[model samples]
Target: MEIPIMFEESDAVEGHHDGLVISLPVAKEHGSSANIIMLDTLKHMNIDEKNIIIKSTMLVGFSGETKKTSGEITLATYAKGVNLQVKFLVIDTLSSYNIILSRPWIHEIRAIPSTYH
Candidate 1:
């Protein structure tokens, strides 16, 4: 099948991580319809198909190569009412966390994660 080209060969942007990226629910809202979890896998995601954004089509076998998307996904945790519409990529490799939390997500949520704190 011929996959239609979606993204152009644009200059690489600054602060781009070449690994997994995911959304983390920080706070919870009352009377919400969505479930917020710490980590979300592809099989357990509630994707909004109506708003699909093509990030890129892979053609290689490397650790950096991952499926990308520009879609909004509901997190399973606190602050479940808010929907995170940031760009996230998926990697089928070993990772400490389900979502890598890319720079875009950090900037959007204005959060700081501490390691072993």
Candidate 2:
């Protein structure tokens, strides 16, 4: 379900919202190497479908279980007054966390997970 928000169409994608801020809940994994997002979340956010690249990825879980990915997408994500173009591996993991911010994101943000939390 899409959360209702009032904003100009141009400001929505431009990051020039003049102080508009939106919050999205997600999980962060310091141990994980790559960022991952639920396929359903991509659809709900109206992202990844238009510019998704067909690339398969193999992921090994903490317990050594494996999952194959369907595709990947690079999107400009805004948070805390910062705009970053982040890459996310797409898969139907059905996780409670729609997006898992991992090492790549943590490093990009120049933040230590231990201290961040």
Candidate 3:
């Protein structure tokens, strides 16, 4: 399914609560830059501040607006019998979703994220 992001669209998926977040391998590599978690989400997740990698990266939106990353952290994430050590890019910017699961993680798990609404 195609998800609209800015003027362009990304294969990146933001799932709803009821859908199982498991992935099946796909050949496309479109969402290489997906899977971002807001810093606010990280705060509630109880992650130690020491674990944040200071080497920040810059992310450009579909509309060409860039968002500078705050930091990064690799978490031992488990979902639907899948254990993935997910490295989440931390962003302090405002967004509607807590996390956008995509790319390597999606391909690894074969994710078909739940309906957006």
| Model 1: ten consecutive residues of lowest lDDT | 30-39
Each model's C-alpha lDDT?
0.39, 0.65, 0.65
Scanning candidate 2 in windows of ten residues, the lowest lDDT window is: 22-31
RMSD of 2: 13.8
In the range 1-117, model 3's lDDT, one tens digit per residue, is 977634223543555355544332111111245667788767766666677897688988879998899888776666566766778788997776667666667668665443542
Point out the higher-scoring one by TM-score: 1 or 3: 3
- Residue 1 of model 1 has an lDDT of 80
What value does the lDDT take at residue 92 in candidate 2? 79
What TM-score does candidate 1 reach?
0.35
Better of 1 and 2 by lDDT: 2
Model 2, span 15-106: residue lDDT tens: 33343222443322211788788888877776647667879989998899999998888766665545677788888778766777776666
Q: What TM-score, over all chains together, does every model reach?
A: 0.35, 0.64, 0.65
lDDT of 1 by residue, 1-117 (tens): 855534334544456555433344532322111121222454445534443333343423236554333333433343234456433443344435544444444544544433212
